[model samples]
Target: MAVLALDPHIAPPAIVLQVADRERPAAGGGRLLPSGFLSTSGSQIVDAGGRSVRIASIGWNGTDSPPGAVLAGLWQVSYRTVLDAIVAGGFNTVRIPWTDAGLDVPLNGYNDRLGWIHTSLNWDLVADPAPDANGRYRYVTTLQLFEKVVSYAGQIGLKVIFDHHTNEGTEQKNGLWFDLGPGSAGRDGGVKGRVTAETFKQNWVRIARTFAGNPTVIGFDLHNEPNGEKGLITWGGGGPTDIKAMCETVGAAIQSVNRDALIICPGPFFYAPPPAASGMDPGFATPSGNLTAAGTNPVKLPIANKLVYTVHEYPDEVSDIARFDLAQSGAAYVDRMNRGWGYLVRDNIAPVWIGEMGSSLRTQADRDWAATLIGYMSGDYGNQGGPTFGPGQQPISGSWWLIGPSNDPPYGIQTEWGIGNFRSEQRDITDRMLMR
Candidate 1:
């Protein structure tokens, strides 16, 4: 019962009409997921059959670019090949990030941006071309490209989570989720100049409706890293600017369209002092401004048994490895997780996913930190190689930061895209996560 979000500016494809007419898999070759619908049940994501499911996931970060440009182009691979490699690497879930501008704008309007890439890059390398009726242009609209990718993901037995990574096509520096004007500093000017909260809600409503009843399309990651200096990040009671209120508004809207939709709410960013260089208290410092903290008066969304809380962790940005060295012990890292999003899971309030966390593993310290963190997440404290966090409660699940095939790797899992080859760091992290 998935609905198609067709751009009004373009002629409707026959495939879209076919999708709109069917209650089951449409004739466009997209298949239904075997695992069925996923819902949350007491800190665990349960499948339609009521079995607990842990997300062993990887992020595909292509939508960070302008409309119609995907990361697969950068690697000279097709979206299918990229996803095939992900499944081959033992990942069951893929987090695909997208910009609001890319999703909202019509295909015809994005021709110039697509043209620049078409001229700049080797055209033969681009994949998933949505040529015109007569096969004149080989470019695909952003929505069409996404649809193909999600269809392929389902065909390969991989779950997909659509992440709204940025409001604009450029880097996601604007802290606020809504009220972003065109030509705003740090945003690549295109499409609508002003993005209102209502627009954001409408966009998500369209998304939820489009993907509704598609079991493989799991959830909506509301926003990526709600951090900025404009005070857009608040847990509750900050008025309309509050993250909690926004999630409630948007989550309710999505649920209104599809009640089974799982809503992922990311924790707000706050500065934390580096752990003590040397002292009895060598643990990581407590973050000062976390909105997810129990003390912050967190709000409970209207959606029942479908809320998944998330927190992003980076070795340098979120946690200072130099100050809180993993070599010392896992106590500091464990304590830090407990105070942050972990408390939600510990208190049986909600399921918390370490939505994003990774590093280059360039140095021995970086390697140690990664190992220790993975070990801790897998309930193996201090790299003891055994579950020690508790009996039934560990952080519910986690997804690696990225799945790129960068030559000079910082946080990529593979060394080459579409080759299905994984770096040692990727192997170590995935292996540890599977233990849970």
Candidate 2:
């Protein structure tokens, strides 16, 4: 293991420095941290050995869907095949998004909601279980299936980031973290039911205990994009409804079960109008919040060296893409990021991971935007034809929005399965991803 040089001006916070000195024991009389576990040091994510590692990852979505299933079933490929494809695609991590209800219920119970869309289980690829009292075969539970997925991913040398994709058992469209309602409808106007914050925390506690010692399961993304009614999107203010408070509450719970677990908190989602006559669109929105102000303070956890701030970015979500041209320059784009979540890295407060970002690259403008964003992540300021970060400012890490078999416009990274060919739209994006 080798140690990378950190920005001298941007020292890690006191809590992180203390953890590195105490928890990260020098191995073989060398500065190497350890292997297996991962923790944050300032704007960098280091392995147990303390070597800097970037999370060039892709989201393996589907856990939020009925039955906690992954896209592997839709692709008719084994979960191993999907994991292999992720590694072969030059990614080091996989973000697995799952729902609380899906994990608590039995596979069959949740699958019933899949109706006609559910794929036949590839039993050989998954877990094997004993028959029930009636001598009938019983499929593995969703929790068991996820454990299998994590185990296989580790076998293939891929890091797993468990994401709480939703509180409901069905599709995730509601922006709230734990929707406790009398009759709340989903984004599709269907009632998916509700869950209390207490129930949400309990499920996470159970999840943390389940994979407490698993090194492959490095990070626990507390919630997917936390946005909804006014109270739900609370940043640092808004009392108990504040997302920062929720993160601290849930993060502490996870750490109690697994101290080494990295707690990732996604920023709030809101629209920010672009500069007047700046050629950018007005309806531009991102799952990032400006935490540079006095009221919007940075998230501080009781535990050390484990908190990671995250945000989601998308092109279509922006108000106007035509005006926000990336071909000419990336100044506007970089500024938008700064106002969103870049401040964390810029100020050296904590490691900021762009948890989700994707584009179809359907048009030249889309392709340019992708290139600019990728260049920024890679620390290639010149590639975007824009101003670069200052001496102490470090490049940030990010993961693509999704990788699935379905060709759902720009979000899908692959059209088919089995690690063959990715969609045409992914050609440019894949090239920019860091292998290690």
lDDT of 2 by residue, 222-320 (tens): 887665323234455444456777788889888888887889987665544333332222245443443333124656777869988887766653423
Candidate 2: how many backbone clashes?
6
Error of 1 at 61 (Å): 1.1
The per-model lDDT (C-alpha) reads 0.59, 0.61
Candidate 2: residue pairs that collide: 33-49, 34-48, 34-49, 279-323, 283-319, 284-319
Worst 10 residues of 1 by lDDT: 274-283
State, as a TM-score between 0 and 1, how close model 1 is to the true structure: 0.75
lDDT of 2 at 210: 91
lDDT of 1 at 114: 37
